[model samples]
Target: MAELSGRFRELQDVTSSPTSGVPLSLTQREPEPHANNPPLYDGDPNSCRAFLSQCLLVFALQPRRYATERLKVAYVITLLTGKGREWGSAVWDAGASFCTDFEEFRAEMTKLFDRSVKGDEAASKLARLRQGGRSVTEYAILFKTLAASCDWNEGALRAMFREGLNFDIQDESRLRLRLRRLAPHSSWRLEETLPSKSHPPPQSPLAEPEPMQLGRIRLSAQEKQQRLVQGLCLYCGGSGHFALSCPLKAKAH
Candidate 1:
């Protein structure tokens, strides 16, 4: 009887061991079917299609959640869709769109475009215009005119204009000429009357003799004393006698 018990215990251990008996691999089981009803999407073609369509709709309506480096793509997408108007309104209501850096602008742009265009042609055009020497206002005008000619919606053009105004081209000469035209009368005259040459003519140091020492003359006691003591004429600080006895003075006399 003891030998039989030992054999039975060995058989029990073998059945419990994973590698021994029928090995039970752990697997996630499918949820059991409800007894009373079925799932809303279970094996129904129409429901499955509807569910997928709704998911796509949500993605389409939602703003893209990733960062993008392409500014033109954002601009074009906003222009094509009505999202640009929404963005402009929000920014206007907030009272400003000029942020601290390009990153903030880009973030705002991405938020404005609900979806991203992988290789948008409109974006390429914007990039080219930016690189070309067109002012933002000029580009916006051209864009609006061209879009209108091509039968694009008017509302989109207006939104694009609002967004484009933030980018201005630097024209130094145009700015200077504009400022000159707008200046006050006095400022204008001052600018206009300024001498062409900054420096005056070079002067000759010894071209003519001074008036007080031009001719020989006798000096008074006071003048001679002043000249001897100070080495300068009493009338002029010249290296001679007083102005009263100067040759120029004698000529006048």
Candidate 2:
């Protein structure tokens, strides 16, 4: 420590001397942007919000840097002019005015994507939602996703989600009862509420009703003549006998 202090004082003494004509070396540098960073907002889909949100995950950034609007804009310019640049081309063809900053750009992109959800619109969409052919898991996913776009609280959201399901789904056993018992504003769980399409609900079609029995009727003379001509006995099943002289049927009298 003493040796280092002596050396520092000696260097200061040398620098303090007016005759020492060596100019002090400046060692400051401007931070350069990363050259290899991938372009954002390619616009295959409405991914601007996702991209921006992901920028906040600073764990992988060198020295954990924050993404500023100006920096984002610089990257945005690159994505506007390459192969698979439909989003950028659309922007240009429409002759939309350039954004003044990152927030304006994001807003315009969000509006373009129809991602800006109004309360009424979102509520109406959520209100009209139905389980349809999808399973409970799929329906839940869609419900939660649509609900995210709206400002409704969990309790009202759950009620609306339940109400929107198909009548069959609502009338389903234990599921309805359990969902009803949940506390307001709480999560509701399903234990196999919706059946898979592969295993549909048991279907028992209306069977043919029982037929009423009727008493046997006596044959008419025209029918008897027809039977006689046809060589069939009237009362008994023998072929040769007629009704009047039928011996097998005579035993009954």
Candidate 3:
């Protein structure tokens, strides 16, 4: 970490203005299409890929902002929390060389935390996955995780997903299959499987609408990104705190 820090300082020195002594990167305006802040990571092996992917997305979208390997790695470290933060702190204290290189940092983190199978291995596990006693949502999350590493097409994936579902869900999905079978000779029509408004499907009691402040307009994707980067409350665009601790958001609840 000392070596990495020294390298970063050397780069900063080279980039510093002769008159102002401020680094050129710091003087430049932030890039557009600001990336959303990734959720804090807790060193869960199952979620490491997702966390890393979010970090990469942020870096990719604002290449100029994260032009240096040190900057990219530093951004990732800021998002670490709980066990993840502990691991990052240890690496920093140990003076690990990989801590400053984005690719090396990613490789090291993946080796330590990425446990998901890929390719044929992932496919095989997905094939054997069962809904069992878990909710459909839970099963689907697991299914999608494994499917991400597989090379299967949509239709094949759909079929595999259906096969792993619980009997009840399978029975429910069969209604769509039945409709398809009835129009085997006709072109596929999605509307055929949908219930009419006159016979609306039952709504789940747990699907209540979230509480919202009156006259509060939805933020656009760009606005959300800006608020997040500014360290402002995402709910009301107030400064000094983030969304989780926003009093306005708490009051709405």
Model 3 accuracy (lDDT, Cα): 0.64
Q: Give the poorly placed runs of model 2, Cα more than 4 Å off.
A: 1-48, 55-67, 77-100, 115-117, 166-253
Model 1 per-residue lDDT tens digits across residues 140-222: 44553333333223322232233233223245345334434533442122123111233221222453444444574434444
- Name the lDDT of candidate 1: 0.35
Query: Please, what is the TM-score per model?
Result: 0.15, 0.41, 0.52
Q: After best superposition, candidate 2 residue 198: deviation in angstroms?
A: 26
On TM-score, the leading prediction is 3
* Model 3 residue 4 lDDT score: 47
What tens-digit string does per-residue lDDT give for candidate 2 at 61-157? 4221323443343334444433224564455445455533566766766556535344666556665677889765577667766677776654445
Instruction: Tell me how far the alpha carbon of residue 75 in candidate 3 is from the true structure, in angstroms, after superposition.
Output: 1.4
Model 3 per-residue lDDT tens digits across residues 1-253:
3454565456555543244664546435544486898999989988899899999998788765567887677667767888888888788668689977999999999999887688767766775777799865567668777877877654445545554555444444555565455446633332142343454333323433323233455555455434444545545677875444456655544
- Position 136, candidate 2: lDDT: 56
lDDT of each: 0.35, 0.48, 0.64
Compared to the true structure, candidate 3 yields what TM-score?
0.52
Clashing pairs in 3: 1-95, 1-96
Error of 3 at 48 (Å): 0.8
